[model samples]
Target: MSDTDKKTVIVFTDGACSGNPGPGGWGALLQWNGQEKEITGGAPDTTNNRMEMRAVIEALNALNQPCHVKIHSDSALIVNAFKQGWVDGWLKRGWKKTNKKPVENRDLWEEMLTAMQPHDVEWIKVKGHSDNERNNRVDRLAVEASRKFQQS
Candidate 1:
């Protein structure tokens, strides 16, 4: 297959927070054929979930156009939400859980959905703090980004 026909992008992402609701950071690595990109950012006050979602958001947004994407993340909340059809159900219920409680990060979820709309995405769960090189790299990137805020 030629490069044009090979439009799949592979990504690995991780999020870290010093405290549940304290400074947080997100890291993402995107690989497409011969090209690779690493992206990271931090927030003064944010939850781990938000950072996790942000890693995906940033990665998807980095794409220049629609393409098939395989996303690897260590967050079960995110991986399960999509793989288990929870996200679909949430959208069907107007972003409410089965108990009718509003989603905690509706804005981020909505953003993720929008970022994902133009692409075919597959969410893959990776073991966190494991020996996976890319996962470990992103995890360190996230922690380093988060600690930047702690030092400030």
Candidate 2:
């Protein structure tokens, strides 16, 4: 591909959990032009949503510039938060729910926004276990990471 035709960046991310509050893992695949990179990590005790947020945060942090980015994920919670503008509303309200309770995962949400500030991002939701090869790969990597954490 010519320089002008090269894709700036594309990322696929997923998170896996052995249990809601058990071992968790996050996986991310970053692609730019003809290059591919993968990142994965796990926590001994955590929630799936935290892992999901971490995947995006780490993926964005991997980039050195404010390049255009496309992010693919299977987590409805993450996808809808951005798509429906819920995240903006949450931040505007100081990360509080309508009922006055603190929003869950606020720290990660804020971190993700900060990491994303330099990029023009487009979030796309992909069906899990479908034909998207990259997404599936990240999903499996997340599960593997989770298993490794559990074993440790």
Candidate 3:
């Protein structure tokens, strides 16, 4: 099919951490039309939430054109923040909580918004270990990435 025919895409992402604040990794799969792409990355030491946000940011950034995008993630913290409209509140309040602390992962959030700016994007929350094949693949890739970091 032609490039214009690729008007919609599906993305699955997952993050893994050896410890809450230890080696971490992120993985994503993007499918458009009949084509598929996979992405994975790791950090020597990080938090799961950071990796979670990174997964979305990296996946969105990989798109070559603005398309209707459906992003699925298993992280409630990331999914709820966007789906519940809490991200808007955080943005309006200058990335600070009501208690006035700087928002965690603000950098990744900014990157995600920037990457998504050209696309119509929807965020969906999926149960991590159920029947979703792509999600399971990403989860395995993420864990593997994290494990590589640990091995080093």
Candidate 4:
């Protein structure tokens, strides 16, 4: 199908960190029709929020071209940032928050914004560690990736 005619892709993403700032990882699952793709990566030392943002940035980057995409994430930090206009406000204020503090995860947020610019994206928030199958799956993937970075 042509890009314009393609079905809206559904994405589920999650991030995990063994010690909040140690051995962090991100996981994403993308589905369009019957086709699915799983993407994951980790950093030996990172914050959970950064990993969360990376999950989304990587998912959007994996798309071949601009298309309608719906992203479901278990992070309010990720969801509210967009749904509540924090990102736009940050951009307008030179990446500072209303209190004039630099936004945390500014780099990942910038990367995510750029990655998402080419697509029509809808962000959906889902409760973490709940009954949501896809969310749970990605969470497991993220945890697994995080464990890989743990000291052996």
Candidate 5:
């Protein structure tokens, strides 16, 4: 949290997929000053992690101004990437993994980094399929969105 003056925004995000590389969707819910907004998007063919990251990317992009953000998500991979310094290491290595393999979802990773630049960001990992209401809502939103692609 860099700026104390920035308004605090709480966000819940989730992603869903019908198949590993099939129809996928991502959802986000943003809350600020007693108001809330929901956003969702779907891809015809994608991975679950990419959809997960997309939820974060879209949520951050929704902010019109720089703010302190707390993002609650069920994805440990996304949370740990930021909280555990994986993003920094990946950057230092030109987006390569420790084994020198190219990182998966590099495009979304780049966009997420850019969308995050204006905010003081905190990633919170939440338990999936648990009792978190907002998280569950976003999950349903993601699943519902992906259902459209599932039929096609």
Candidate 6:
């Protein structure tokens, strides 16, 4: 199928972690053709970046068919990775960073890219904690999901 034949999906995503490597959560709101689906999840031990990456991956995975996806995320880590060709460079360089350190969350990055394979994806960076209602709501969803672990 061609890109023009695919459904256009708009998504908002966010992630939160209580501590740098503490409990974390990811949230995504996907909308298409006047319908909306919200997805959220938590991890007992994880990092914010992982959760951020997961949000995009999970949302894309939820789609049953190929789509033209527009993802709005507050995470520059994920957005810039794609927009700046970091992922391509890393793939070419054997998944190692410029400093020769193994890239963190390589597993998730691989899975995310695999899930993204069937879609036309555009990553848009949004300001965190700003005026976007969808972003703010997803942020709350992630925070609340993480807080569930905190209270347990």
| Candidate maximizing lDDT | 5
lDDT of 5 by residue, 75-126 (tens): 9999999999998999999999999999898999999999999999988999
* Total clashes in model 5, counting residue pairs 3 or more apart in sequence or in different chains: 0
Model 6 lDDT at residue 65? 99
Best model per TM-score: 6
Candidate 6 structure quality by residue, lDDT tens digits, 1-152: 98889999999999999998999999999999999999999898899999898999999999999999999999999999999999998999899988888899999999999999999999999999999999999999899888877755
State how far residue 9 of model 1 sits from its true place (Å).
0.8
Compute the lDDT of residue 34 as modeled in candidate 1.
Answer: 84
Task: Give the RMSD in angstroms, all C-alphas superposed, for model 3.
Answer: 2.7
Residues 40-102 of candidate 3 have per-residue lDDT tens digits of 999999999999889998998998888888999999988888889888999899999878899
User: Over the full model, what C-alpha lDDT does candidate 6 score relative to the true structure?
Assistant: 0.94
The runs of at least 3 residues in candidate 2 whose Cα sits more than 4 Å from the true structure, single-residue gaps closed, are: 1-7
lDDT of 5 at 98: 90
Comparing 2 and 5 on lDDT, the stronger one:
5
Query: Which residue pairs in candidate 6 have backbone atoms (N, alpha carbon, C) closer than 3 angstroms, thus clashing?
Result: none
Lowest lDDT 10-residue stretch of candidate 6: 143-152
Query: Model 2 — TM-score against the truth?
Result: 0.91
- On residues 1-152, what C-alpha lDDT tens digit does candidate 4 reach at each position? 46577559999999999997899899999999899999999999998998889999999999997788999999998899889998889989999999999998877887898998888889999999999999999999899999889999
Candidate number that wins on TM-score, 4 or 5: 5
Evaluated against the true structure, the overall lDDT of model 5 is 0.95
For candidate 5, give the lDDT of residue 2: 47
Quote the lDDT for 90 in model 2: 85
Whichever of 2 and 3 has more lDDT, that candidate is: 2
Q: Provide the lDDT at 89 for model 4.
A: 94
